[model samples]
Target: MAKKPDWSKEEQAVQAVQLAFDLSNDIQRAFRVSAALQDMSTADMVRKVLQLPYRRARARPRLTVTLKDEDFELLAQKYRLDPQDRAAIRHRVAEELQGFARNYLTDSGH
Candidate 1:
């Protein structure tokens, strides 16, 4: 089932357009992102581009990272999260960074 969007989300879409308009020196490029995000969830669109996981209920990806018990504990304490939650966050962030590098470095023509 498709989720209903809230008003704040709609506003962010508008804000994204405004940002594009402000930043993009070229009208065509500003219009391009604006149009592309139209009829789509702006939050999701930005998150996907930034490689962030969806905010909705999602099955956690299975990713292994070796961390010492002390390190894990420290992270959990600092973030006020359980070990599992900390692991999940770390994995998601790492994946996002990796994807960003791949997309930006390998795909973009500098």
Candidate 2:
């Protein structure tokens, strides 16, 4: 048997609903540039323009990138690791990013 809904009626009433849509490439780029120039996230800028309530910020900030299967394979090859060992590849990628920051910081005397 399928499991029942986890949310209570009152809880569901207050749940946030996502609004997502696609835009043409030119329009999308313009929107992104506008947001960046104003130092606002695209989502936050959109909310302000639409007169919607702001989102609650996460307690911890995190960076994210979406990688395709081919991208993963490339990373594995670059790092000389098994493609199946995704965790190790991710660790290596993180190390590379940290090294990049460290190098820039040292070079710029920051």
Candidate 3:
């Protein structure tokens, strides 16, 4: 006779919506470290990061900018950005620039 597998209720619940993917070693390490720092499981950290209500402080048209290495370094220093993540650096710059624009427009009555 084959032995039956044992599963907890929480495990069974997660199985219903669980998704799996292969991540690079660096990203996996970062995820695990972040989860440990937050005192949460990697699964919960992933869920929180990906599951969003999608709220924005203001609606603005999207724009892209190209920065040279020196320029990026300057921005990273000024903004204290994470140099390893280009996408995150871009996002932080965009948000800061948008806020400045909004404040300037309001002050100038535009």
Best-fitting candidate, scored by TM-score: 2
Best by lDDT: 2
lDDT scores in order: 0.59, 0.81, 0.74
Clashing pairs in 1: none
RMSD of each: 16.2, 7.0, 15.2
What's model 3's lDDT at 19?
71
- Native-referenced Cα lDDT, model 1: 0.59
Model 2 clashing residue pairs (backbone): none
Which 10 consecutive positions of candidate 2 have the poorest summed lDDT?
54-63
**Candidate 3 structure quality by residue, lDDT tens digits, 53-94:** 432321343455779988778888877876666777788888
Q: TM-score of model 2 relative to the true fold?
A: 0.51
Better of 2 and 3 by TM-score: 2
Instruction: Quote each prediction's TM-score.
Output: 0.24, 0.51, 0.38
Best of the two (2, 3) by lDDT: 2
Number of residue pairs clashing in candidate 1, backbone atoms closer than 3 angstroms, sequence gap of 3 or more or interchain: 0
lDDT of 1 by residue, 1-110 (tens): 98886669668877754333244456555444553445334444555656777444223433456777787777767656687686565865576668986887787584
Worst 10 residues of 1 by lDDT: 54-63
